[model samples]
Every structure is written in structure tokens, then in C-alpha cells.
Target: MSHSRVNNQPAGQHGMVVAPGGGGNRNAQNMPVDADGRDWSNGLCGCCSSCGTCICATVLPCVVYGKNKHRYQHLDQQGTPEPSPGCCSGSCVAHGIFAACGLGFIFQMVNRGHVRHRYNIKGSGCGDCCTSFWCSPCQLVQESREIELEEQSFGTGRY
Candidate 1:
């Protein structure tokens, strides 16, 4: 009687291609892929690890948020310093005006959505709404770190 062994090798480890007719890994298929294939950074607490950023976030949260917004939107130039992250970016005048009117939070929300889209991060850890409402500073910190991470990882220089 002829005997045959089952192909029990681990997927993607047996020199198997990832295309059709090759070993398929559901886990690998589900991994998020940015333009440069770098994973997104950690959460808001990551800012604390950086002394300067933590201080900035605690002191002038609005300004930090503005920069984070500009970075996330991928605007060019050393854009004007904004008091807030505007609906769009790179315009400090509009940012100042919008912030004074208490509309900066809304602008921040929009940018937060953009960050999520770019990094493919799913909303979790008490949901986006609760996080933004209860701990806006944390959200700002997280976004800032993500922008920094995106730039450092992908060399986008957006931040």
C-alpha cells in the first residue's frame, strides 16, 4: 500500500506564496497595512513617554491639537501656527478664529476621523464618543502621537 503524508507545514513558513493556490493565512489577511506597511503607534498615554510632548499636551493642548490636525491632513509647508486645528489645515488665522468660537473641538473630531481612516484603527477602549467627551486631552495626545509615528515610520514629513 502506498502512503502519503499530509502537508502539515505552517502557513507562510514553508516557502509558500501568499497568492492564489498558495498557503492562505486569515490572520495575515486581516492585518492593517499603511502606505509604508508600518503599524500604527500606541494610545494617548504614549505621549507621557516623551517628556516634551507630555508637557505640551498638558499645558497648551489646543496648540498641540492644531499641529496634530495639520499633520494628519498631510498639508505642505511650515504652516502658520494655529490656536486650533481648523476644519482644514495650515491656516492659523482660521484656526484662531474657530478656536475662540469653541468650534475647535468639532474640527478636532474631524481630524480624529481622518487619523482613524489613515491608520485603520477601530474605535474601542470605551468608544470614540465617550473618549472624546470625557477625556479630550487624551484623544488629542493619541492623535498627536499617531501623526508623529506616521511621519517617523513612513517619512511623510506631514507632521
Candidate 2:
């Protein structure tokens, strides 16, 4: 019972210890969006709107998706770094570029979710999964257009 009181502070070597189990940035700001809050085009509406992308999506979906996906990852990379590795995994340009290996939709689907969050698009995880699963190309086109529109309005000049 003769112990001396110690300072109530973390060890100096610990630096800044980020809390585990979701205490950091819950809202991802990697990709900025405009305050306009415009509604997005339907996933199936790419044909009449963006015939070029629609045709490319139909003819060479792999090429179109590969380029776009890689570009998406790069956009995120140029922004604020994620708090943790698991915060975002599909931000690899190389991997996204090779997203034509049939299993790439999994990664693109995840990326789509991030885009939705960035643009404040109202939707459920199940909805994103279904859109990505059914018409991945259309999803890509919609995402690309959304990004372009946001960049144009916000004038981020990053993309």
C-alpha cells in the first residue's frame, strides 16, 4: 500500500493509437461530389445517353472496364489516404486494370459502393450488388458519367 501515483497518459512510444472497431473515419471522402445532389442515371440508361460508352461496354467491356476501374482506383489514391488498409482494398490501379478476369466484378462492385457513398446516392448494399451483378457494364458507364459530372461541377481538377 505504499505505491506512488503515476500520470494517466499513454506511453510516449505509442504515438497516436487509432481505436479499433470503427472509431476513425466512417465516411469516406476519397472522392468529392457536388452539393447539387442530382439523381444518377439508371444503370440501363447508358445506351441513349452515352452511345460510345454503351457500344464500348457491349463490344469490349473488358477494355472499357479495365481502363475505368484503374482510373477509379487512381482517383482515390490521389485523394486522402484511407485510415486503414481494410478501409478500401480495390484501389489498386493494376488490379483494377486487369478487372476483366471474370472475377473482377467483385472488386468493381465494391468500388461502386464507394462511389455511391461519395455521391450521396441513396441505395442499399443489395441494390448495388444487384446492379453490379446484372449489368456491370451499365454500372461502369453510370459511375463514369457520375464522376465526370461531379468533377465538372465541383471543379476538383483532379480527375
Candidate 3:
């Protein structure tokens, strides 16, 4: 049998090598990474950070979930200082329905996303889902702490 060269390309030209953090597709200069992005002020498992929040989340998650939505909406409205929503707000009822079906994680995940977006917190949708699904009460309290901190900083004065 006769030997013949089947491939002509050189081995050295297989691919391009780029340095880490070299403004590649992920961190392109024009993309402008948000320096303002921040970690959650309260850790997911740091329920002890606020005893009241922890208790409320564990005892009445629906209430916490509803209030989180309520407070986030008020914050979105930019200092309107809406009256405090009752514990049985629409969000609470929705949360109760979802929780009854053992699917409250879905609602909590979305709520967590809203919290993340509103505060420019450093987290992804998947992460929020996992955190919310795995430990809902902890996630609720964590979100509660973050929002409460923001409210305080903005002088909302409604804990």
C-alpha cells in the first residue's frame, strides 16, 4: 500500500489562544461590567442575622413572601411610601396556593429574581432557583434582610 498525506492543515493552527480576562466575549469592553453589583448583604443561611425575619419566614412564609413583593413594588415606585400591605395580600394567597401544591419554589425563585434585579445583587436565575428550592425559609429571610436594608438606606422607615 502507498502512503499519502490525507490532511494538509498544520497542527499549530488548530485554534486561537486567549489570555484569561482578556476582554473576551464574556467581558468585552463595551459590555461594561457592573462595578455596582454586590453580594447579598445577608447570607442565604444567615437567618440568625435577623431573628424576627427567621421566625416569620419559618412560621408564615406566605406572609414574608407577600411582604417581599409588596416592599419591592414600593421600592420600584421610587419613594412613594405606600402603606404596608396586609399579611393576606394577593401575593400571600398566591404563595399559599403554590405552597399547597409543593411548588412554592417557583414563586420564591421569581420573587428572588425580582429582589436580585431591583438591588443589582450579584446572582443568577439558576442560583436563585436552587437557593429558593433548597431552603425556602432561609431564602425568604435573606431576601427580607436585603430589602429591609435597602428600605432603611432609602429612609423608608417601615420595617
Candidate 4:
């Protein structure tokens, strides 16, 4: 049995591998709070904190959901790709469709989980589902604010 090696190293494409403590790992950065995790930057009921977002969410929830999801996905990334396919295409459309069928909460709930995970915000999947289901408008606004705050911290200069 013979094994091929490169300079006595394993032979394979390792370009995507990020060496530990070698830098370039964004997720390795410090989380905001202690090991118990941190509370959401904005309270669940703090809808009035951003009136325009609340109004937009109330009037056009699909658009708001799409926009929030888009922003959240790109929160820590660099560069301006596009807004989000869902914003102008599938995302908003599916949200509208699900809303009409009374299942819009499911879509937003998944995104809510992503936001919580990204920020290390303390909350359960059940809680996120309930929040998305019960107070959708407020959830949308809250997520919008959270993503906005993160973007501000990153200094991307686009809101």
C-alpha cells in the first residue's frame, strides 16, 4: 500500500481550510456577553423604537421580512452584492403567498433563529417561533432594528 503526499503532507485541496489561531476566522471573535449569552438588543415589544419600520412591517410585511432576511444574511460580510433575491423576487413573493395562506410565520421564524444564532442572543427556538407567529409585525421591526444595529457597528455605511 502506497500513499501519495505533498512534502510529507496530506494531498488534497486545503485552500478553504482556515488554520486555527492563524487568523481569518470571523466567527472566532468574542461574543458580546458572558457564557450565559446575551439578551436581544431591542426588546420584543419595542416596536415604537423605529416607527417607520413598524409602519412598513404593518403595511407590507412581505417586503419587510424579505429585507430583514437579506440584511441579516449579509450582516458581517463585506461588499455590496445585491439586495436579495427574495426582496425583488422569490423571498417577498413567497412571504406574501404564505401570509395569504396563514403560514407566513414559519418563514420568518427560521430567519429569526438565524439572527439569534448570529448575534448569540439568548432565546429558544420555541420562543422565536412564538414571537414570529404571535407578534409578526413587532418581530419584523425588532429584527430590522437588530440587523441595522449590527450593520452600524460594522460601519458598512449602508442602511
| Candidate 2: clashing pairs of residues | none
lDDT tens per residue, model 2, 89-145: 334444346554556567667777776665556566787788777887788788776
Score residue 154 of candidate 4 by CA lDDT: 44
- For 71-120, candidate 1 gives per-residue lDDT tens digits of 54442233222223454335434545676776656656666766665555
Of 1 and 3, the candidate ahead on TM-score is 3
Candidate 1 vs 4: which has more lDDT = 4
Can you tell me which runs of candidate 2 are displaced by over 4 Å?
1-38, 41-43, 79-102, 154-159
Candidate 3: where are CA atoms >4 Å away? 1-36
What is candidate 2's TM-score against the reference?
A: 0.53
TM-scores, each model vs. reference: 0.53, 0.53, 0.72, 0.72
User: Tens-digit lDDT track for model 3 on 1-159?
Assistant: 334453553342112222221211211112222554566666777998788878988888899999888877775664443366667789999998988898888989998997776555677999999998899999999887776765555454565
**Candidate 1 backbone clash number:** 0
User: Comparing candidate 1 with candidate 4, which one achieves the higher TM-score?
Assistant: 4
Write down the RMSD of all candidates, one decimal each: 12.2, 11.2, 15.3, 7.7
CA shift of 118, model 3, Å: 1.2
Clashing pairs in 1: none
